[model samples]
Each structure stands twice: as C-alpha cells, then as structure tokens.
Target: MELCFGWFLLVASIPAIFAQDISHGSIVVDGTMTVAQTDDNFVCATIDWWPHDKCNYDQCPWHYTSVMNLNLSHPFLAKAIQAFNRLRIRVGGSLQDQVLYDVGNLKSPCHPFQKMKDGLFGFSKGCLHMERWDELNRFFKETGAMVTFGLNALHGRHKIKRSLWGGDWDSSNAQDFMKYTVSKGYQIDSWEFGNELSGNGIGAHVHADQYGKDLVNLRRIINELYKGSQSKPSLVAPGGFYDEEWFVKLLQTSGFGVIDVMSHHMYNLGAGVDPKLVSKILNPDHLNKAAYTFGNLTHIIRRHGPWTSAWVGESGGAYNSGGAHVSNTFVNSFWYLDQLGMASKYHTKVYCRQTLIGGNYGLLNATTFVPNPDYYSGLLWHRLMGKVVLNVESHASPFLRSYAHCSKGRTGVTLLVINLSNQTNFIMNAQNSINLKLAANEQNISRESFTHSLKKTFSWVGTKASDDALLREEYHLTPKDGYLRSRTMVLNGIPLELTSTGDIPSLNPVRVNVKSPITISPLSIAFIVFPNFEAPACG
Candidate 1:
C-alpha cells in the first residue's frame, strides 16, 4: 500500500516537474535610432584549403575538401550556397600564403601539398591549376556565390627567421593570375591578400611596412588588370589576429583607399580540444569577451582607416579545426548566433565563418553533405535579419540575450532573443520608439515603468486594422532532443531537415497574440517578427 501511494504521488507531480519557471522581463526596442548597419551580403562562409591529412587532437577531420579536391558536382553544395541568395564565400586559410597559382609564367612543374618535416603546417607548397580555378569560378557562377580569393602574400619572400618572412612580395605571379581571371570574365567581389600574415602570423609573419608597400603594389596591379571595368573588386588584407600596434601601422603605411576591408581572425573560445568547450559557449561572460575586439576594431576603423570597414574574415568559436563533437552540434549555434548578432551590433560589415564545409566546424557535414544546426541558424538569419540594427535592452537576466533589427525587406522589426538559462522561460514585453518619446515627455512616469505594460499599443497604429494585426510571428529554435549536444534542430514543434531531393526546408513561424507577453522557452532562441508593429524607423 505504501508503494502504491508513492506511485500515485509521482504521477501527480509530473506536470510541475516537466514545467519550467516563468520570469517576467521588459525589452525596450528603440526603433527610432539605428545602432549600426551590416553589409547586404552579411552572411558569409569560407571554403578552406586544408588537405585530408590535416589532423588535430589525434583526429583527422578534414577529408577531400580543399579548393583542389572538393566535389563541385555535389548537389547539396550548390543548393546550400544558392539558399543564401548571394552568399559571400572566402577561399583562403593558413596554407593560403604557401599556395602558388599555375596560371602564367614558366616555372617548375606545379605540385600538390606533400607532408614536409619542417614545412609550414607540415605541408609543402600547394598549386592551383588554371583548369581547377576555372572549374571553381564556374561553380561560383552557377551558385551565385560571391568570391573573395586570397593571394599568396608570401610568394617570392624569403624566410628570415623562425616564422618571420621578409622581402617584397612578387606580384608577377599574382598579376598573371588576376589577368587570367579577368580574361575568363569571372565575377569576383573582392581580392584578399594573404591569410594570417599580420602580428606574428600563424605559420609566417611579415613586417607591417613591407605588407603595406606590397598592398599598394597589389592595388596598382588590380587597377591595371581590371581597368575601366564596371565592377572593380575591393582589396582586403592582413587576415590575422587583432594586434592594435600591428593593425595601426598597416593602415597608416598602406594609407586610406588602398585597403577596402581590414580583415581579422578570431578564436575567442580557445582551442577546440578543450574539455570545457560547451560550458564556455553557454557562459554569457565568456561570450562577452569578444566585444572588446569588435568594439576596438570599430574604433580603429572610424579613426584610422575610415575608407575601409572591418570584417571578421574568419571565426570558428573554438579554432584548430573546431571541436569534433561540439562545433557541428546544436550547442554551437548558441555561440555562432550570439557572435553574429554581436558583430552586427558593433558595425561589422561582414562576418565569414571558418568554413562552408570541410572542417568539423563546417555548416554542412563533411561526409553526408547534410546541413547542421548552425546552417539552419545562418539561413534564418539571412532570411530575417535586416542590415539596420536597432537598440534593444533587456533588464531581465544576464543569461538572456536580446538583439533587435529592422525586418529584412519588411515593415516591422525582428527581435532575436536567446535564452541561455536551462530552467527559466522568460516572458518579456516589447515596446517601440513611441514609448521612449512618450516617457521622455511625461515626467511623472519613469522609463522603467514605460516598458512594463500589458496590451502595449503604439499611438501611430491607432488600432488593429485586421485580425492578423494583433498577432506576431514567432520562430522558436531548440535542439531536437532535450540534450544540448543534439545535431538536429527543432523549430517550434517540428524538426528541421532537408528534403530527399536535397532542397533546403522552408522556415515557417507560428502566429501568437501580440498583446500578450512573449514567452521564450529556456535554452532556446526566439525570432519574433512584429510585422504590423509600428516601428517608425523601419518605415
């Protein structure tokens, strides 16, 4: 009888046990002021040139996925790129400096990368044949992918010391490659010089002044190569870690208008082999650490190189090929999405992920060519997030992250809210800029009081014109399973997966009453679009 009574008690407590706690909060989206703006093709991914033998932490994750070996005929590959409309694809990596193009000039026979005892990253110089280059351009054309090819910045420069490289960059080979590209009628959006040749580069380092001089020469070559062309490519350089002194000199020496985009690489979460990788991704404090770099870069661009903007040329939360299990899983989306929103807020023009495919961090699976959770996140971001960033504040909790932007090609605002907490489902009320102005004029009411209200209505939109006007679209994203490490993503209540024919699944949202507070589930992200909401700035 005692056991029976215990069973009855357990059954009674199931609802409360499974339910999450509700925390009330306020989110004031000041749509009147635009905080920042990102590029139209803000969503970007990279296709690295790592060979199949590139191993890390006792694991070989990269397979036949370099520029020379990636299967261009793969249907998933083309569909994925086309999904972004015009996804900016950067082709470069650590080995980019050692790469030599086989386009023009009479030199030694071109060869593939071979294992070398003391070679940069343990591999000899790699070559890109003209045929392969033409194939890549044709693939880009078919997929409508914007290309930003990285030139061999270390070509013709002799190694001075351990990792220090000195001497002028030989532009002959690069010019020949550019001339061929122009002759083929390929459309390249930008030409990036070097990989990580700035501030004690990854495998090789170059002095700032020398790099600057070489950049000026590269600019001259570009002008000559594409003279009178309607669409002249922009120049981007110094794709490396952020070094205040090194970056300042590169800009000062190269001077303004020479470099169009100052690119940098970021691996804020440390190495991929760390055991504490997932824990760090969930920590708000750890994520906020990247703000210093982004904020500082914004200042540097506005002050030093006003002509050129900043781009997170390459960022994979945990570098060194990314965590084998963690990076490609759903948990990585927390870090990836947060960084994208944070970068956009800081006026970062473009943020290219470490890879489109190949590494463990690739948006698509290396073996199956399947879209991972982060892939869906990127697609939604591309389909939803507009260029204009809006000011959004959440006094709810430190764990809750909120970012608002004018809706992409729409008449309202889209609020991206990420709940890092595992137990608290936040209920927040969103107000437009009208509240800010109203509260500013009425001295009796405090700003805090202005944000907290039920059935908050905007004065401009006198009343609901139709039944749909009272609703907002909500896209709740969570792991397929309750586990944070799940590879699949669940949107609302349905699982996100590709069709049998390899087409990307359409992202659909459910409409919820706008008068009621938005209930964001714990450990989930909500992209709520207020289509009919009166956002004067958006208008």
Candidate 2:
C-alpha cells in the first residue's frame, strides 16, 4: 500500500437559509402599482344605456335618479376619471326614447315620446337640453373622462331604404344631435350604432347581414354630418351578444375600417338564477372563464381585419336582472377586480361595466347612493393601481390566486390577492426582500337587526343604531360590528389597528427583510404594497 495510514477526511455541508422579515402599517397606498402596457389596454367605466333617461327617477323609479345625480359629483367619479380615461353610455332600453328626446332637445317635456305621436317629424321636435349636458361636461372636465355614445338602432326608429351601399337615411335629427355635441366642445369619441341588435328579447331583432348593411349606412351619415368637425366620432356597429357566427359574417361583409371598435356583451349565467346559480356570478374561477370568452372574441375580430380596438361595450355579472344574494355581497369585489385584470390581460382597451347605478348588478345601491363593494373595488383600482402592468408571478393554489403590478416609475408594487376557498388558509412568500403594507376585510358586512333577525341589510356603508356614540356615527361596520377594526403587522414593531374615524393609529412602515413570507387568511382580499423595491426586469 502506497499510503498505509491514509487520513479519512469528512466534510459537513450546511444548507443556506435566507432570512427575511416584513413590516405592516396603516394608510392604504393608492395609485402605486405597476401593470404591463399593451396596445389592447384601455380603462373605461360604463354609462348605463340611456344614462340620462335611466337616471331620471320620475321616469324610471326602479332605476333610481337621485343616486345618479349624486354620482355626477361623487369622489368615485373623480377616481374613475383618474384611472380610466374612457366611458360609454348605452342608449337603448325602455328609456331610449327619453334619452333621444332629452339629448336632442333640453326643453323637451319628460312625457313619454309616443312613436304614434312622434313619427319622423316628431323625432326632431324636442329641443336639445344644454343644462344636463353642462352637468355631464362639468364631471368630465373634473375627471378627464371621454364619452362614447351608443345610438338607438332598434328597427322601427331609423330604417335603411336599400341595402349596404345606398339607402335614404332618415337620421337627420341624430346627425344634428352629434353636431350640437361637437358645437358644445364635448368630444364624442365614438358612437356605437346599436345595443345588442342580434338579441331577440329587448330590442329589434335582425340578422347579421341586415345589421351590417344598416351599420354601413349609419357610418355614412355620421361621417357626412361631422366631416369637418373636431369631434368627429368613429361609428361602431351591431353590438353583438355571444353570436360568433353573426360577428364573423358582420365583420366579413361590413367594409373594413368602417367600424372603429368591435363591441360585444357577455353575462355568464350557466343556467337560470336559482340560489345555486347565483353563487356562480361571484365565483373567482368563473371570472377567469369570462376572460377566455372575451379573448376568443378578440381573436375572431382580429382574424377579420385589424380594428382600432375591442371593447366589452355592455356587460354585467348576470344578464337576467342579476342574482338575488351574491350580486350584492362584498365578495363581488373579487369578481369586479378580476374582470378588469383579465380585460387588461387580453389587451381589451375599454371595459364598460353594465350599469353604474341601476339593475341589480349596479355598482352603487340604487336606493341610497351608497357605494357597493364593487364601487369600493373600483375606487381602490383608481386610487392605488396605475396603468402599467407588471410581471407578477405567484404559486398557484385553488384557495389563492394573485396579480401584482408596479406603480408607474416603480414607487410601489400592489398585489391584489384573493382567497377563493371557503375555509383553507394560504401563505404568500416574497421572492425578494421588500417593504409591505396590508389591508384586509371579509366579504360580508351585513348583520341581522336586534328587533328582527330575519331581516338583514348592509350595516357597513349605511346608518345603524348602536349604544355607543362612536359606533352609531360610523357608517361602515368592522369585524366587531360596532367599531371599524383592521390590523397592520410590521416586522419588528407592534401591530396597529385602524380606528373607526378612518385613521391609522400611530403605525409606522416597518421594513421587511428579504425573502420573508406573508400569510393570508381564508376568504379575504388583501392589498399588499411593496415600497422601495427595484423595478422588475422586463424584456
């Protein structure tokens, strides 16, 4: 043996563990998240079809006008203006005649414009209402929200004398209205020629070829009327439902570039709205399914020829008056945020959420003008998240799915995480060291009254009686039902709770060490802000 006494050497390997800690605080960050920019990205809030008419309570009490009037001045509108620069007012419904008359002539009587009385001559009789227009303009100025007006295309109103190429157009009054809007310096960005023209129930039903022909004629009149005007509005056509075949035919026959945006409506009601079916509307997984539908439509339109953009011109969680219970719950916020996020993903520029303050699915409670969970969700997106989309990667779990965006310039990163599981808990670990702030609340804020447990109402954003003065005055209920309470956890500092007065109680932003993990409770929506982090690397 060359070496009789070979020394045995042993090496012990030590595992590398990265130590990290996170901090929490109050003062929820706003407008500090980043999102990716794509050609298809545009933000828009919806103006209900026939908003002026829909908001007139005396005319449509169930639709609620008072709240609509208030929304014109609501801080929420300003927030929306900041977030999305575009808006659409769907113009056909039971209230179509009223809007046409009101927008056409300001002094027109509120009385119903009977088709028998207001034949072709009667349509132009109403005077354009400048007062309401001023009110609308004032809000637009404050928020910088542009408008897309939807034209009423129901068959009997405006008819095409011939086929696609030449037709005696009877839309002089509508043309004048566009002229007036331009004269007033109100920029009508685009005019969608109709509501869901292919749908059978509400409006005039027409085949794809007939609708496409009518659309071409309508475009001609709009172009002829506003040819030299600064407010030349692009004409959109045949707002389709889920009829893909119809959409394909319309795109093929309709001349290219005639329509600025391809529009469609989607409401997922797998079956009827029974108790079991209502839950589907607010389900987070269900939200992703709607995005796939939107994506497919975008691809179909692209296949025809490139258009300016695509928009979910008219959409809500439910089509048949919305669901009973789930539509009003705080859980709906997840659905709303998810829809916006998904629309952004597909590069769909503008998403007009069905009705702002009517229908069971309205973002605001029609009766009180109080903001609903969806409204709060909108407010959060407007205030905190910026337009830029960032690459957010998360470990997938059925219980939790998240999207993250860095605010423009990387001031902060916002993680919008949802816990879909009814009972399972989830933990989120940061891949890098970053500062964090958290705010969370449960989906349900309603409580049974002491007098009658059977009757329940939203106790969070409305008035209620309580023995304590502080509790009685606070509008929103907290985890305690009497006081607003939320905790902020920091890495090495004491956790602080938010007070009923909406102030953070002496909490400071604590630094979180690198590679720390943050845990989330079940059925909660938590917004985490990461400050002082480097911009994520982008290709």
Candidate 3:
C-alpha cells in the first residue's frame, strides 16, 4: 500500500445494506462514422521534478521519482514503460518553471532543488545537469517512449507581486538545452512551455499575451536548432487550468500555425485531503463536470488555434500531490478512465496523467516501481482502443459511462463501459447503431436516439448480418477485497501483479458469446472487444 493514508478508509462505512436492481442497458456503437480522432499516442503519463522533501499533508510521497533521480535501471520501470510499445512520457510539473537547464551555462552554480522561504512554491530554483539529461534520454530510448519536455517559462521573469511574475521569458537556457538535445540525436516528441501558470495561476501567474509572444520566440529557436532535421518536436503550451479569456488571447497573440498542442490541466476532485474523495470519484455528476472544460477547449481551439489540438498536459483527480489512499487505489480508475474516454470524445490528442511515478497520483508506486490500478487502465486503452473514436449512444443511467473506438490494429470496435454504482450491476449489450431496434415489448425505432428500455434483459446480436455466434473479449477490473481504496486490482478474478522477475503479467481477457450480455459488475469496469463487429469506419 503506497501512500497508505486515511483518505478513503471510511468509504465503506455506513454502506448500503439493501440490494439494488440490475439495470439492462443497450450500448449502440456507431459503425458508419467517427466523431473524433486521437493521436496514436493518446495514453500519456508525466514524471515530475519534485524532491523527497515535497511533502503534502505531513506525508512525503514523492521519493526518488523526480526526472533527475528516478531509478532508470530498475527492471520493472523499463518493462512497465515498454508495455505500451511507445508510451508518451511527459517530463514536467509545477517546479519545471523554476528549473535551470545545465547546458552551456556558466553564469550560476547549478544545484538541486532546495526548500527556501521566499522561493516560488517555497522551493528554490532547481537544475537539470546535462549528464542526467543524457541518461534520461538513454532510458527513454531503451524503453521506446515518446518524450515531451516542459521548459521553464519563468527563466528571465521576476516576481512582481505576491503571485504575478513579469518581464520577458529568457529562451537562452531552453534553446541551449534543445541544441544539446539535437546535437546528441535525442528524439523528443514535443516541448511544452510552462506549467500551471495560466488563469490566476497556481503558485505563480503570467500574462497570456506575453506568454504567447515568448512562444513565437520558442518556435523560432526550434526552427533554428533543428534546421536540417526532417522532423522537429511539436510546441505545446500553457499547461495549466483552462481560462477561456486567457486561452483566446494566447491563441490570437500567437497567431495561427504557432502552437501544435493546446495543453491544459485539471483536478476536478478538488484537494487530495478532502474527506469525500471516494464519493466524488464515484459520482456521475462530478465525473461529467469535466465535460465543460474539454468541450470548451474544443470550441476555443477550433475558433482561435485551429492549427493546434488539445492535450491534458497534467491531470490528477485530486490536486495537492493527490489523495494518499484515494488517488493511488483501484477506484481511481473510474475517474481516470471516464476522463480518458471523455477527452477522446472531444478530440484530445494526448492526455498526460499527472505523474508516472511521483506523489500519490503516480501510475507506479513512487519507490517500489510497481504498477498501480490506473497503470493497467492506461495500458488497456493503449492496447485495445485505436485513434478513431466512434459514436456510442446509451440512455442508461449516467452511472454507466460508455465509449467506443475502432479496435487498435484490429477489425470491429472496442467498447469501454464503466459502472460507477456500488449497488447496481449493468447488463450491457452492444448493438450496431446502424438501425438498432428495441426488445419484444417496444416498437421498432431508428438508431439516432438508440436507448433500450428493458423488457426484462435485452438480447445481444452480431453487428453484421450473420447467424454465426461470435465471442467478445472482456477484461473486467474490480477492486481487491471490495475495498475501493485497495491498491491491488483484480482483473477478471486474477490479481494484476508483476512476475518474480518484475515483468508485467499477461492481461488476457475472457471470451463471451455474442448472445450474452456484457456483464459489468457494480463498481467495476469492462473493456469489451467485439472482434466480428461490422464497423465500416474501421474497415
């Protein structure tokens, strides 16, 4: 149990005693068209710069997980990353703005982060040594990961007030770092500028107009540094909370064709220490609230930065280092997976999780290098779902969150169904949305508003016009021991754990016949792959 705090210990106290009804839901998968598309590398995670002393709620969770000190040689570390053929690893965090790159720099002494009274976020400026950077690049290459480095946007700025940072951004250090990266042939996928310094800012603030102008300079530097290279890393910026007015201004100021990725962050569950963390994670209303941000970002990007796309540069359900027992537990996948589905629906190219290994929000245990429940969730999405997102219409309770995509490198579609209710089980059926019909008791209807009001349990049929019985692959995930805060995850009755040699276990799914409904147990998630689905869009 990593970061074993009491945040969700009482989640089961005063639990429901009465048994609930089993709901019959029909999930209509649109096969003819796609509503949105994501990047091939949609599953992304982050590594932060927090030191051992970066404690929250009197607990020091960030241990040896900073970009500078992570155990790159650890067997599990490499294997976990390698599991995703090419996991998108975003190397950045709050302290990235206070960081100084130690490459071709002779002005100041490069040192590690030190806790200081007057420093930003109470942490003094940290330094990233060139040698360490080289080592990181080597590890990334060995693990076959795509890297997105966050540059220090406050390099030349000074604190003008309590929260305001002023003056022009100094691109010299970042430019030197990029030049060194290019010289060494290090392959970086993207370079993100700044952290949570948008809106009113988190710990520090900056004007959007100035940030935009500095981004122009950054793009120029990227062009100069990688001039002859056939491909250059993309520019992602303003990795912070979504501020409509500020976002509009930044894009207008930067003009078109400047930003490649419009990245933002979120912590919809509020603070990590809140008592109702588990409740918020399970509540459908709370989960759907993030749709506003994602939807608005889609609109804003379309209007102002049409050249760019959206990326959730950083998002941990709870903000301050995340919740100890809540964020690192199996139940957190409800929030994580739902957000992943929602983001893809809004055309988000990449959703960078807050920490791959740091704090309570890490996918891997900060010190043990073991995968958490959300890690399995991410790996499943990367392996099963493809870039083309199809339309899935379900009129079941909001408790059932469903998303469909063309199966990755396979025919048919993959349906992700999450049952958030702790008392009700969802008997889900996947029918083609082409011309879906109701059960025996209901009248025939079109597929536009395809919802099934159950006359008992609705039957599941093949998406194609065939009498052949097909089997779907299902991966059901539930918390170990019915504990929502349990760190261990049980996948299809088998616990997901590394081998004695520290390798990821095989995630094999159970096959069920097409006539059988996809059974989603209470508080469980299922990634059902219909191998024989007649999806014309995927074809």
Per-candidate TM-score against the hidden true structure: 0.93, 0.65, 0.92
Q: Please, what are the lDDT tens digits per residue for candidate 2 over residues 78-107? A: 553444444344433333322443455334
Against the true structure, whose TM-score is highest?
A: 1
Where does the lowest 10-residue lDDT sum fall in candidate 3?
1-10
Over all chains combined, what TM-score does candidate 3 have?
0.92
lDDT of 1 by residue, 374-486 (tens): 99999999889999999998789889999988889888889899998888878787776565455456556656655442124332232333333366788889898667888
Q: Which stretches of candidate 3 lie over 4 Å from their true place?
A: 1-18, 437-463
Give the C-alpha miss distance for residue 318 in model 3, angstroms: 0.4
Overall lDDT per candidate, in order of appearance: 0.87, 0.49, 0.87
Give stretches of model 1 more than 4 Å off.
Answer: 1-19, 439-469
Two-way lDDT contest, 2 vs 3, winner:
3
TM-score ranking from best candidate downward: 1, 3, 2
Candidate 2 yields a Cα-based lDDT of 0.49
Off by over 4 Å in 2: 1-43, 49-63, 66-99, 102-110, 113-131, 155-169, 199-202, 222-232, 269-273, 281-285, 388-395, 406-413, 432-514, 531-539
Ranking by lDDT: 3, 1, 2
